[model samples]
Target chain A: MTAAAPTDRTRLRRAHERGHHDRATIDAILDATPQCAVGYTIDGAPYVTPTLHWREGDHVYWHGSSASRALRACDRAEVCLTVSILDGFVLARSGFHHSVNSRSVMLFGTAFKVTDPAEKEARLTAFIDGLFPGRTGMLRPNTEQEIKSTTILGLEIAETSAKVRSGPPKDDEEDYELPIWAGVIPVAMQAGDPIRDTRNRDGVELPAHLRGWRWPG
Target chain B: MTAAAPTDRTRLRRAHERGHHDRATIDAILDATPQCAVGYTIDGAPYVTPTLHWREGDHVYWHGSSASRALRACDRAEVCLTVSILDGFVLARSGFHHSVNSRSVMLFGTAFKVTDPAEKEARLTAFIDGLFPGRTGMLRPNTEQEIKSTTILGLEIAETSAKVRSGPPKDDEEDYELPIWAGVIPVAMQAGDPIRDTRNRDGVELPAHLRGWRWPG
Candidate 1:
């Protein structure tokens, strides 16, 4: 695990309840979800593009079309990447104080575009295998033109902080006397029935791992 | 329903998909989630703050401490407010193309601070009732000091677009010959057992709606 970057911006709120700046906690949250809303600015206007991401050690990687202006603006620029999991709703007696129990990580760093053809291919391969392990070797590798048309950016974990609010809701002391009810309505990600494409060719069987995969707890 | 603000940015990728831009789709996604990550920048530094929000007509409202820099920066400044709901994971043949089926709304508009005391109070009440229907009438109203310490901002839905990807994963046509599995793992939010606060008074029964609240489909 990489040591958390030391900076005032990286410090957790209520340090005691911060659950520590552990790399495992950060990695778990990143791996639990497949998508993130990448927030960046172009000409002082804020724009957010949701894209699939994967983590390798302390760095996160995402790819977009080479022609994407948002991706072009993000290359080598300071970016704020966030991934959040809505665990449950925290209902409280006081309406103003109601909150949600969630786990999220905000990473602030400058993204370095992968321009090396070999490195880009390897990173893109690792990204795919990260989400669907053991499948990289079976598919045809990206052609040179394909590699040139995709822009991959890697953001180092600098000045990153995780803010998690968990457990039950905390209502105001005075509002405890009110007759309203308060508790969590938990949210979860569950696997549904799989639908195979009609264009699937003959003699293909779904892998056991994919057929029985469950969301990490 | 108010007509969607006309702009090249608000246009849908497929014209047929433009019909989903009506008020019903926007309101349904907004009302489903109470929290949103409001993205803005101060002096070119990007910041994303999570806050509770409510929608009325073609506008969205969010409040924070009067001293909040993000809120103050948003006043009269162009802002990008996004709401995303992750429905399932897209398991594609290539990891680079792995994605999630999600619904997200991005709106670009100038925000105006709500300083009128009476209108601020009304917005606060609407925020509460929007999440927990009928509860605002049962609780005591906000005090003058509480109202004064908070600033509410409204962003008109000037230029808005909704992007949604659902159903099974879309793998490359040629990759279908590979033996790898490809399908979606559905995700959902489920209710949990309620935990009564230790300080609760006697004879307070949970409301009927609270007992069986469900996430909209």
Candidate 2:
């Protein structure tokens, strides 16, 4: 895949070595995580809301209550969707060099509500199956009113940038000899063991997908 | 001691029950998360950049390279800082009710660079001590050159709102009786064992505070 063209909006001014404008890198970061923070403005005031996001090829989608003000502002304005996964905390011999190991993406685009009933239903089904494979068939299908109450926003991936930081902290040359215990404390955002619903149907097996899906360490 | 006034900007348009404006709740969420996504506009284009954030009282600060375009644009423009912690995944019997148990804060205010030499140094020191406890004395002090290359933006908490979703997913009354396995898969972003730097100074101990500072489970 070709690298995304670096428009004025997507260029990095510092640590340019960590910046990547390639679709491959951006797509990888988006796929690894399901949560994102969306930034949008209303009457000149900016707001960032954390929401669940998923990608299908070059398009990304997120949904919310149809009555959400943040989503409403997002649909009517240019939005920035950012996804970041914190891998670890970097400790350096010098205070100045401390950082974090992370992979993140910033995608700039506009979002619009997914309004078609059939399309929304299919997308919502994809969401369920995306999280728990083959489980959508097990649960009742979305009701017509349920589809109407949800707002799914789709943004074509354009002007995107991905940044990655990994490995040990880079302390100043002289400070490396200092006696501070410097290293990284790995941060794992893991999904713990599932708690079956108190009212769950008796003997329903935990699906394999739910049992296996975990954030990459 | 008083609640933040709910204005047109901070009011929730949906699920008003989940909205909170008290400074105590807002401060609690900010204290727990180390990362935040900042939203700001430059020439009518919106951008969201994730960076490390810390709080001291009602004021919050985040830093980046002084040459960063995003930070430069942020210093002059209005900004929004948002922090979110996903506590668990809510699996409801109905797809429409599926949500995540999370604590999030959206703080809106204009950001200005912490330009004073002594003030910036103190705040940066606070950031280090705040995260690592009594480690600043162990690490090499920052050189003046290092201070010159960093830009820290401070935003006083003026208009902020906190939204929380916890407990089990609130399924429709009828769907709860369905045969679907519905419950929460608890998610935690925790620190793992520290990996010593390959070139660490001999016998430097891992400070006790570093081992103990963890988010409430």
TM-score of chain A of each: 0.89, 0.95
List the candidates' TM-scores in order.
0.87, 0.95
Clash count per candidate: 1, 0
Candidate 1 wrongly placed segments (more than 4 Å): A2-8, A11-24, A138-140, B2-24, B94-97, B169-180
What does candidate 1's lDDT look like per residue over A32-121, in tens digits? 876676878877777776676888877899987797776888898878888877777776776556667788877888888989999999
* lDDT by residue for model 2 (A67-162), tens: 887788889579999999888889888878999999999988878788899999888887767766776776767888888988999998987888
The interface RMSD value for candidate 2 stands at 1.5
DockQ (Cα-based) for each candidate: 0.47, 0.74
Cα lDDT tens digits, model 1, B16-104, are 35235666677777777765767787778666665667888878999977876668888998788888777777767765556677777
Clashing pairs in 1: A128-B95
Task: State residue A129's C-alpha deviation in candidate 1, in Å.
Answer: 2.9
- Best candidate, DockQ-wise? 2
Q: How does the DockQ of candidate 1 come out? A: 0.47
CA RMSD per model (angstroms) = 3.2, 1.8
Please name the candidate that would achieve the greatest lDDT relative to the true structure: 2
Model 1 residue A131 lDDT score: 57
Against the unseen true structure, what C-alpha lDDT does each candidate score?
0.73, 0.84
